[model samples]
Target: MGAPPQPRAPSRRVKLFSAWFWLYLVASLTVFWFAVVIPWLVITPFDRRRRFSHWYAYTWANHLHAVSPFWTIVVEHAERMRADQAYVLVCNHQSSGDILTMFSLRKQFRWVAKRGLFALPFLGWMMAMAGYVGIKRGDKRSRERMMAKCRRQLELGNTIAMFPEGTRSTTRHMRPFKRGAFVLACESNKPVLPVIMVGTHETLPRDSWVFTLERKIYPVLRVLEPIEPAAHDHDPERLADAVCERMTAAIEQLRAEIEARGGLEVRPPQ
Candidate 1:
């Protein structure tokens, strides 16, 4: 028999076109910020900014996803979402695109992000409007301040999304989960919801902005059931490890399932 037909990858021209799409979207969002979002921020009441910003970001991100032929996002377990209750969302860090998935959840949650992201011109402004908490790495006071802000947000019945590993992982192996998210969850007495996002790394991997479509890329957002606070309320450090173990196991199971179904093609080595 003749050789089978190979999958048609995105042509360079298509990639280039998608690049322009991103640029145009960013530019448009900028105009959007200055013309609409910014004006409302300045004039709107403080309490109202949170809701408005979440709405704006969700709409903008959805538009971005729609225009970009680069990604096919499949959001699962959406029915499990309880908008009425607050949660501490924990997810693996793979690529910057993970940020969009966070906004995709369409919840008014404050993200615990590195202070560096707060420096990207329009992106930083959008983040600020979204009520994200910025943490200065290696600074104790910064960590405390971030935790304090997180606690307050949780108390207010607002969700908080955190990549407990602190930085993006370049491979399939997840970075060691940090204690911040677990500690905060314990202190705030909130449930921890584990999230698994596959295929983001393939979209825009570390040190490479040039989008690659070696294979059709479709990222999935799967939310595992919540992990309620431990009954003993042990030391924060110990509780953190327990939380990490749970997340690690969840990731492994998801990875295996994805591989078994042949849904994910790229499993970058640790």
Candidate 2:
């Protein structure tokens, strides 16, 4: 019998096209920011600037996802978000795309990002202008300043989003949770809202700019019940542990649900 035909490798031309597509999209968005977002932000009142910037960011993220043919995003329990209450939002960090997935919540919140991220040309400038908090790792003084800024935002009834894992996990398993977000929640007396994200790592792994092609990337995010500050007696360590446990469990459940639905296969971090 004749040898069976071998499966063909993905075409190099297609890979190049995909990479170029992302580069073009990024350039287009940067132009849109300078041409539209920046002009409006400059004219907006200081008091409303943060909210306006967040809205613009949310619009940009959604627009990017909408234009990407290989991506699909699903969010559950988003209605659990209470419009009247501000929370310390914490989530697992898997990929850079997690930021856009979080924006799918469409909630108003300032991000606690690395100081380096805030130094990027246009995006970093936008983040600073939008009043997002930045922390310099290993610098005690910077940490103090970041926390104080976060506390002020909480006092003003603004939510703050943080990735308690600190950095993207290299493997499917989550890295150790950091105490900063929990401490901020305790000090600010804001409830801790835990969100679980799955499938983002597969879509866009760490340190890579190219999108995985020819596959449907279904990223799922679930908003779990918020943990009231009183539940942990204002203890940051206990609060952190409790939140981490709940999020771990929730991720497992989400994985099982995805498996049952015959959607994209979610792999553990390496």
Candidate 3:
């Protein structure tokens, strides 16, 4: 199955540490939010694109992970992200924490996320404030509107980031990518940047509210070379498949490297 063993019972020490960690996280996060509220309100009117809001959100995420000893994030090939290019970023879905790890790339893109995420407490509100694009799941009208918005943002010279899987996978195996993001890239004539993430589902599952207490989580982020316009023949379906195939190969290659380095061992592929 290429999936890690299911969660085991937390020891008493783990339970205690998790409890303490959550409290510390919640309290510190409140401060992180409030600290930026004034700056956010001040910048919203002057900054037409809301780029500051985007930076604020990701900076908060990066700092949160930075302070937590439980997490060690390694972002590879970040320099591949250039400031001059506005790309339609195509990323895989691994876990909610993928936001923290992926967004740490700080690529200056507006996120395209599902509607329910905006309903989440501070995190969702941050997405709204950061001008992220949201689509209602299974709602055709909502999707159409979202596409229109993304197109406008692209024209305005803003990069767009999307998780084409639509939802997180339950295992190491990735879900099928939806076509919307690739369609947008073709329509806009922008490059498709594949962001591959590892080590999320094994630690932070979509259904779990509490993070693992005993295990230290290391999320690896790899940014491959952009799929240039010349590569896909301006076809969304072909582009989607090309991207999916490239990412799948890279994921397996990354797992092998991790194994070779004696890094945190991922479950072997079936």
Scored against the true structure, residue 194 in model 3 reaches a CA lDDT of 92
Superposed Cα RMSD, model 1: 5.9
RMSD of each: 5.9, 6.1, 3.5
* Model 1 misplaced stretches (Cα beyond 4 Å): 1-11, 14-18, 46-49, 231-234, 264-270
TM-score of 2: 0.89
Whole-model Cα lDDT of every candidate shown, in order: 0.74, 0.80, 0.80
Residue 23 displacement in candidate 1 (angstroms): 1.7
What lDDT tens digits, residue by residue, belong to model 2 across residues 1-270?
A: 222122244357547756876787668668757865656656666555277777777887787778776776777888777878899999998887899889888888899999998878778877876779999999999999999999888887889999999998777667899899988888888899999998887676676665554565678888999998789899999999999899988988887777787756442232
* Ranked by lDDT, top first: 2, 3, 1
Candidate 3 yields a Cα-based lDDT of: 0.80
TM-score, one value per model: 0.84, 0.89, 0.89
Candidate 1 lDDT over 49-154, as tens digits, reads: 3766767778888878887755667777765558887888888888777888666666567788889988988878888877888999999999999999888888
Pairs that collide, model 2: 171-269, 171-270, 172-268, 172-269, 172-270
CA lDDT, candidate 2, residue 145 = 98
Best by TM-score: 3
Q: What lDDT score is found at residue 113 in candidate 2?
A: 91
Q: lDDT at 13 for candidate 2?
A: 57
